[model samples]
Target: MKSAAKATPAEDSAETSTQLIRDSIRVAIVERRLSPGTKLSENDVGNLFNVSRTLARAALQALSYEGLVSVAKNRGAFVAYPSPDEARQIFAARRLVEPGILREAAARITPDDISQLKQLLLEEGRLMSERGQTARRAEIKASGDFHLRLAEISGNAIMQRFMEELVARSSLVIALYGQSTVSSCGHSEHGDIIAAIEGDDLDRACRLMLHHIAHIEADLDLRERKSLGLKEAFEL
Candidate 1:
């Protein structure tokens, strides 16, 4: 079967509509564009990206699979509002998954992977250095790209898919309960992880990955949700 994914053109060619939908929502969540409980209407998303509702459904379903959004029987879809316990579980899962990926990558990461990872870091650092913690396109792009790059090194498509999903959900959790919008995910830890991996210290690389995820969990305020309108903004 052909995958639900279909490639696009130039800038769009690199990402399919489903991936686009997944990423758009992910960005909105990470950058505080969509807060917890934000309603996502199908028609809205279809219009924003100029796609059919069919494609939008695919995107939303992909996110639901990742636990970033909830699609109710009759209520349509809304951003996930993870309970504190659920939040803890998410981080715990990340601690295991990410560290394993780091350790495996350290064992087999190629020079090209290192080069790409470094390039990605440069983009991430640039995003963080911007004047404001703006939800600029580049910032969102970098956030997702970081996970994609790591998954590339991990060399397992299924688990890598899980990481991508987890990363998206992590963004949702951050948007909802984040303590400060300044830095939802630490901007510098990737380099530390890379350095450890490059030095062939698998233990240290694993530790660094664990610590990085812990820092993200620490950023969550866990109090309650705020109102950001990805739904209303793009009508999606």
Candidate 2:
């Protein structure tokens, strides 16, 4: 068989830059630094990242496919501002799938997996006590990682992918409508879920997981907003 042709140097550079811009923006959104409905004009994004507008548009388009950004016909891109119904639907999706995910994870979970999960919980707790945007962001990501990790342990590739998207989109929902700064399930509840898993109580684990998702959904205020600025959201 012939070896595949490699990307040209310029193509490689553009691809790497596009990925970096996309990831940076995704992280900002997940960390709540970027608010829902914040405009992400190609020109502004290009200027902020020091890339061409084409690259900026590419990045935004990537995010749109992830359900994190919304691109308009003539307007441009904005962080997705999930409505109350949309937020409800997101949580419903979680509620429907997480129990099954948890069950699968429980069936396959190893002691090492439990240790890693506990470590994530510990790191999340530490970040909760720390004061700063960085700490808060880490805490939020770690919180989501708890669920993502569980999905990983489940050994289901499709469910893992779904969980990733669900978690990312959930970040957007919580950023827009959450009453508290805390996102995802509560910190203690994570420990409880882990304990249930470790104890081989899959039934209890599933129950805790459902409660955890419900708790997150209950914290949403789900109201409309007037305006948002992308420059401020990016802190650029």
Candidate 3:
């Protein structure tokens, strides 16, 4: 058997730059810094990130595959504006899977995992108190990270990937529809779920998981809103 060829330095650089752009855009979307329907012009993105248009296009295309960006013919790329029905579907999927994921995570969770979860909860609560767009964005990301971390602890690779999509989509939905200034996932609720899991109460943990997801769904207004300007939305 022949060994696989390695990527040259130039190829590695391009891939790194592309991934960096993609991740920056993804974080902006997921953290609600960028609103739905905001245009992501390749030229602007290239200039913003100091990369070529080709690299920017690649980044946008990558986000499109993740259901976080929409690329239309002749319309350019925009942050995904999920419809009300799509929002319902996103929560529906999360409600269907998160309880199971929570249970599996509980089954496999170690002491270190529990400690890490507690630490995340602490950080999340601290962020909630701080005032600033940057802190708010970090808080939102940390809230989503709680669920994503649970999926990671489940020891199911496929479920982990699915949860990633669901969480990202959920962020978009909440960004457009959420009535509260804070994320729909409550700070106390995360702590409660962790407590249940620590106490070996899988049933309560699952129920709490469902309720947590439901709280997010219940907070949605689900009406259309005008898009924020890219410069203001991204604070560029």
lDDT string for model 3 (1-236, tens) is 14421211124344488899999999889988889999999999999999899999999999999899999999899999999889999999999999989988888888988999999999999999999888888899999999999988888878987898899999999888888876647999999999999999889888988998888888899764446667667885
Per-candidate local distance difference test: 0.73, 0.87, 0.88
TM-score of 3: 0.86
Better of 1 and 2 by lDDT: 2
Pairs with backbone N, CA or C atoms under 3 Å apart (clashes), candidate 1: 8-13, 9-13, 44-235, 45-236
Candidate 2 has a TM-score of 0.85
TM-score of predicted structure 1: 0.77
- Show how many residue pairs clash in every candidate, following the order shown: 4, 0, 0
In angstroms, the error of model 2 at 127 is 1.1
Q: Residues 1-236, candidate 1: write the lDDT tens digits.
A: 15522112125345776798778777677556788788888888888889998888788887787788889987788888777778777788888787777766666688877988898888888777776546454575576667667765767777777877777767666655677755436667778878888888888878887888788788887753334466755666
Encode model 2's per-residue lDDT on 130-214: one tens digit a residue.
9888888899999998999988888887788788889999998888788975654699999999999888889998999899999
Sort the predicted structures by TM-score, highest score first.
Answer: 3, 2, 1
